[model samples]
Target: MRVLIVGAGSAGLTCAWRLAREPSTEVVLIDAGVDPGPDVPSFLLRDMVLPPPFYWDYAEFDRGYFLPRGKLFGGTSAVNATAAVRGHPWCYDAWGSPSWRWERCLPSFRAIEADMQFGAEPYHGHAGPVPITRCELGGFDHALGDAYVRRGLARIADHNAPGHLGFGPFPTNRIGDDRASTLRTLLPELRGRPNVTLRPQTEAVRVVMAHGEARGVLVRTAQGDEQLLEADRVVLSGGTFGSPEMLFASGIGPADGLRTAGLPVHVDAPEVGANLVDHPYVQMGIEVSDPAKPAAPPGKGALLTFELDGPGHLQAHAFAYRTRAVDPSADPCSAAVTCALLTPESRGRLELGTGRARVRLNHLSSDVDARRMAEIVARVADVVADLASEGALRLPADPWWHADDLPAACRREVVTYHHPVGTCRMGSDTASVVDEALRVRGVERLMVADASVMPSLPRGQTNLGAMMIGHRAAEFLLEAPPP
Candidate 1:
């Protein structure tokens, strides 16, 4: 059987690698962009230094913003922060899908990760394609860990551990001296496989469908010429924004939305571009009084999460980090810390623009959501201030300590964590585009296997969740015996 995977991101690359391992299957991967240039630096690999000559464009939403999602061979993974985190157990249960529960999905997460630094743990898998490493702790990580413990927060050895919670530097999908992106981990393994062909600089315009089934794809080459590729099955892994836009252009979204663009409707799936949700992060940066010396270089730090309680709120997810905490003296110039409210109550949507292929996100549209985010920021600020007051840490005597000043902490900042999800939600309801197994409810031979399919936001970061979805989608496709 021939399989075609679109978008060479983590999900697309993972699916290709998994399927290519099967002796009887022929796999082909297509990407709409080229590889990162030799002169370009990766955010994860370049010692957390900002990449030189930023490659992509950003789309401004309401108040918050979206980064320029990569369109390269490795997708955003090639340039993301490389933080590895799995969603909470409730993330799956709330989706109303049996195949997505924590128990069923944990195996896949284990199968893809080869954790080297943290050693063998029951929840961690040792023989996966990707390498998971824990950043060696510095004074900040130790101080934060100690503070969390003193405050009666649970002490977790591993955040990736199922049902585990507490404070620590969550494991990263970065290998020694390199970021463990799909390009390096998954795609490299399948390089010599004859059955798998990677075609970069090939933009998929739309899914070619007939009689309610996906026949193949229409693509635009680097030369700006149009071409068609026929395949038995079409997997849309173009991510939250690209995937839905392609589907809508192919006449598969809401009839009204499609009609506004003067396109004929094929599959009247109104929910294709609706229900978009993202983890809006409110962050604050505090300069340390006595900045620690960098052991390696600047931009090395660990990520820490905390659970907060509010009136009528059972639990909320918030995270923090002391920049330069990984290698204390990495940057001798200055030391800073950043704290973000990860699971803000704010939800957003992705809408098609009047022009062709133009997409915009209505981020932070609800005032209630904004207030929730503000509360999280206020809480994080308080925590930092408390730690400073106790002499556990020292905060610079700066006037910009308020949560409202978060937007100015970093220049041109945005929230993606590479976790844009829920644009193509899955459920039993009529409004959902896909079913439990990631299969398009009303279409044949077409499925979405990326973060976009997440019905709701996950608790932590989303790299692991996206890859797990790819792995599970492949399993379901193989077991169902695609026709």
Candidate 2:
């Protein structure tokens, strides 16, 4: 059987790798951008950590804040900060399906990571392609992370351990001197394997549907030639924005929206480009005067987790280095802490623009979110006060920090964590675009295996979760009877 998988990102790579092992099944993986192969120079590795060539440049409706999505083989996992955080267990339980419970998802999670610090533990896997390393901080920075441990929070060296709630080193998907991108790890392992074709610079424009079944996809090849590729099954791993936009362009999605865009409606899936969610983030700058002889650390460390009302409600990620030039004369060292509301009540939407995907990230649109940010900021102020006493960290009494109207400040200061999910939500409900098995409703041999299918947001970074979705998709397809 021939299967076509569009988008060679985190999820797509994982799914394609699993299917390529079956000699009876032919797997074709396609992406829109160039891969640059495994010969990336070490000098340029740090620059590669930031989004550039593969990023899809998007912006908020009014704020014009940049929103980027990786558009290449490894996708965002290749460009992200290498954070490997698995959210609190309740994050999965909230999905309301046993198939997606934390217990069920943990095995896939284990199967994907080779945790350096916790490989022998029952929860972590030691043989996966992805190398998970624990971040360790030296010097004075260790004192700061330890302060939280003293505050009665559970001391957890392993962030994935049961009841992990305190501050320590962050687990990252980095292998020694390099980032563990799927192309560098998983894809390389599948190279030269039979029954697998990996093509870059090939864009999938739309899914070809016939009699309510997915037959194949129409594509624009690297040479700018348009072509049709047929397959017995098709999976859309194009991601949060790409998946929904592909659906909209393929004669699916809301009838009104499709008609207005001069496209014929097929399935009339209204939820195709709706229910967008992201963590609302706030970055606070800190300055340290040299004359004060403040203790400064060398390496970055720790993402402190907290519970405001319930599990994994909020998080604080802080860096020890300077972010901006505070004063030119003194050349004071500066640092920053990023705080975010994890379980946001706000919802956003994605629309197809003339040149790009238009996003209306209606951040802080809910009263519950406003209150949560307010409370989170207040708690931060208290923590900053204690840290500032030794002159190591200076939390300036900025207008936003001292403002009496905090709710209004929250509205203005909110930014995305870039963890968008739910564009093509999955569930058993009729309104959902896909079922519990991730098969698209009203379509045969079609599935969505990306962050877009998340019914609700996971209360942490989404790269690991997205990879697991790809693993699950492959299992479902393998277990099903062939068409």
lDDT of each: 0.69, 0.78
Best prediction by TM-score: 2
Q: Against the true structure, what is every candidate's RMSD?
A: 4.2, 3.1
- Evaluate model 1: give its TM-score: 0.86
Candidate 2 has an lDDT of 0.78
Where in model 2 is the C-alpha error above 4 Å? 48-51, 288-300, 310-332, 397-399
lDDT (tens digit, per residue) of candidate 2 on 338-437:
6788788899988866766788878889988888888877776666667778655666766376679887887888888789999999887899999999
Best by lDDT: 2
lDDT of 1 by residue, 113-144 (tens): 88885548766788998988777667555665
